[model samples]
Target: MSLIVRVAARGDGITADGRHAASAAPGDTLTDTGEVIPGPHHQPPPCRHFPECGGCQLQHLDDDSYAAFVADRIATALAAQGIEADLRPTALSPPRTRRRATLHAEGGLIGFTEQASHRIVDMRECHVLHPALFVLVGPLRALVQRLRPKGRVELHLTLADQGVDLLVKATLPPGLAAAEAITAFAQAHALARLSIDEGYGPEARWEPQPVTVTLGGTPVALPSAAFLQATAEGEAALVAAVREATAGAATVADLFAGLGTFALALPAKVYAAEGARDAHLALKAASAQRPLFTEHRDLFRRPLTVAELDRFDAIVLDPPRAGAREQIAKIEAAKTPRLAYVSCNPSSFARDAKALCEGGWRLDWVQPVGQFRWSTHVELAARFSR
Candidate 1:
């Protein structure tokens, strides 16, 4: 028997004897025939879908092991880039806390795709999705089965302030009967907004009132496909880290700010820059009388130049998964006194952190966030100062 030492980025636990066992957790033992024997770190997976569902990967690990895995993922990435800092304890969101999710539906099944495969798991029970979101899965399956959607349908659900905001994407446009049927489902569920994308752009069929998501106490208009932090607790943790990272700053620039998540939270005057038009306009509409300012700018194509970056007392960055390579280059060259970098991809973050450190900025500390609980995906907020 071989003992599992640590979990890898792909959710496989590596044993001390250099063996990779699937669905194994740290402290677990692996037999010669690749059978996993549960150990101290292993826990019974709550969901019946276990190793099949792609929504989660490390459900077999206990909370302690899961938190360790989260920190290790970040530490490994930082080490790869020869960067080091104070790695704080991982902040884990509890089960049923996923406020937003994208699920798949085909034939009469609805759930996340099977691990590394196109097949659907047909989820009957979910442990990660918020109760408000999970309650609609069965109804959605029945609705899709009735609609008999040609091939596959994508369901995007987000719990908004009003209610559930649902977006459905199907192969072909819905006919009159199908449209009416979908409208009935929306009404029955009391959905905040229901939009359908049938090859073309989203067209709202039933929207009694505007949908908004409250971020940092400000209700910003919720775009159909707007991005949101996976869980509220995770968002709180990140927001807290960011607030700590850029504390006491009077002027701040929020790069890649989506609907002013960090911009509205900061007490100082904030310049919120976003790429999406709907998000920018929504933020503009909501910023009335607030110190926060909104600008429609794509930092990827046109990053803030060094001179413009130098104007801010501190900067808050929440770039996409690809990381802000272009923007980071400019921030490295700028004379900004402080920065709070919130990242979803540790590799890209480590790469950018290395650049900043090489450019004379001190890598102060990092706070890891496991918003995608029980999954290998890790996020973090880091502070850098000169």
Candidate 2:
């Protein structure tokens, strides 16, 4: 038998382990459920839909509490390798920093999934996205409703400097034709670019245009398809952190230097290597006329040799999620003196940090940047000395 008992949670009941507690009171024991349920007030996000909506689990937790969660994770990972490091307080981007999101486009109507279920939650307003994108949601939905695209579409809404970029990946059925209509809608809304993908398989039709964004009052552009940190302030914070970690350095090598975000910010003579031609071009364009120069090439396939490493005093890496394992291996072989590693994934960062320590380097400091807020993600910059 189920009872409508009030949960201790502020004003709503609580759910545990995917099962609703018989009562809504805190620390209530229900024999029917055969479990002890903590009261609602003890839980975060007193909303009745909390346990259902996957949107925010830490709503019940304050910022200080959440900072502890991230700190523990980082501390544990570092302690395992006999490294002593402090996990600083987390930094967050202002509300609506999520410039891009992939919403499900079904039957020409776009929507996002509910917290825990595949059930779509038709949303005309997203709180975490930029205002420019937020305003477009309604118009975009109206356009989709009119078009009624045949198959489920992956609609990408990006915040570009000049305007928004709308990328739609879907197949359209005859009679419900709205390709030109969609493009016209975007143009009418003053969107910067509107790209559509229509192919299938590994070779999908996608755009290779550069994603231009103005950072620090300067236009910084990179391949739209390449990896980019989500938020503007987040990227700026990362650049600042890396600069703080590598200050007073004489010569530096920025491996996997995407757009030279770190290299361009540093005063040292930097040797940047990017895997893509587009990124390399943007980086060169940014560094042109300046004393700093870059080489267009891949870093992992053919890493800098020991003799090559002799040209630089320190190395800073901002590799993709897979991390700079190959480049680290080369540095280990070369016995590089100092290094600074920036990563979005802690697990990969820990692994590479271990490799560096084993190769005669010591962990100096670790700074955590809460780039992606309201999510279980962390970004960090670690300094090491040989």
Candidate 3:
């Protein structure tokens, strides 16, 4: 029998001899008969959809084991680039803390997609979603049934200040009856807001008041399909790291600033840049009384040049999954003294870290964050100084 020593990046268990076993947890043993002997690290998955639903993969592992998996993922990514840093203790968000999620509905089945398949799991209970979000599952199902969508529909749910903000992506066009039914559903649920997306972008069907998400101690209007952190605790963890990383900086530039998550919270005067028109406007509106400047610019295509970057004493950037190669290049050439990089993907973060390291910036430390708990996804915030 071979012992499952560790977990791979994709949630597969790796044996001592480097054999990958599906659905195997660390400390489990693989027998010659192709069976897995459950180990101490293996815990009964809370969700019955485990091994089927694609939403979660590491639920079978104990809390300690899961934290190690999250830390190891960042360590492995850094090792790949021959970069070393002080890897801090992993911060794992508690179960039932997820505030944002996207669910699929089709043929009266509404839930996440099946593992490696397109079929929906018809979720009865979700262990990851916040109690507020989970309660809306039934209401969403009723809305889908009333719409009678010919094909699959997507439901994007986010917990807002008032209540859950529900967005339904329907396949067919909504008629008079469908619209009335949706309006009633919103009022019955007392949802913060409800919007529907046909072929074009999402349009508000029912909103008693303006929809807003409080970030950095301020309420910012939440545009349709707005990007937000997965969990509240996770957002706090990331924000704390950013604050510590940029402490004492007089002026800071927040790139890819969505609704001023870090800009408004920082103590220094912040110049925030965002590409989305709605997000940019929301940030601008929210920063009216603060010393925060807002700009709408696509950082990927036209990253701040070295001259533009030099205006700030420090910088903070949270780019998408692909990472900010272009922006990092300019930072490397600039005289910015400090940087706080928050990333959702470790591989890309390490790649960008390599560039900064080679360009004279020191990789101070990295704080691993598990926003999407019971899953293989990883997020981190790091500090870089020149």
Residue 127 in model 3: lDDT: 92
The per-model lDDT (C-alpha) reads: 0.93, 0.66, 0.91
User: How much is the lDDT of residue 239 in candidate 1?
Assistant: 96
Ten contiguous residues minimizing lDDT sum, candidate 3: 170-179
> 1-386 in candidate 2: lDDT tens per residue?
33323322122333353335422333444446456444333334444444344433444434554454455556666777777775656666655787766676565445666665776556654545678877876777777677666667777777876677777776655542465676568668877667666655212123235447654344667344345677777787788877777788888988888776787778888888887887888778877756567887677788778788767878888888788788888787665677888987777788888887788777887777765544556678878877
Q: How do the candidates rank by lDDT, highest first?
A: 1, 3, 2
Question: Which of 2 and 3 is the better model by TM-score?
Answer: 3
| Top-lDDT structure, candidate number | 1
Clashing residue pairs in candidate 1 (N, C-alpha, C atoms within 3 angstroms): none
lDDT by residue (1-386, candidate 1, tens digit) is 89999999999999877899899999998998989999998999999998899999999999999999999999999999997779999999999999999999998889999989999999999999999999999999999988887789999999999999999998654469887898899999999999988879888888898899988788889999789999999999999999999999999999999888898899899999999999999999889979988899999999999999999999999999999999999999999899999999999999999999999999999999999989899999999999
Work out the TM-score per prediction: 0.98, 0.79, 0.98
Estimate candidate 2's alpha-carbon lDDT, on a 0 to 1 scale. Answer: 0.66
**CA shift of 84, model 2, Å:** 2.6
Name the regions of candidate 1 deviating beyond 4 angstroms.
172-174
Deviation from native of the Cα of residue 119 in model 2, angstroms: 4.5
Clashes counted in candidate 3 amount to 0
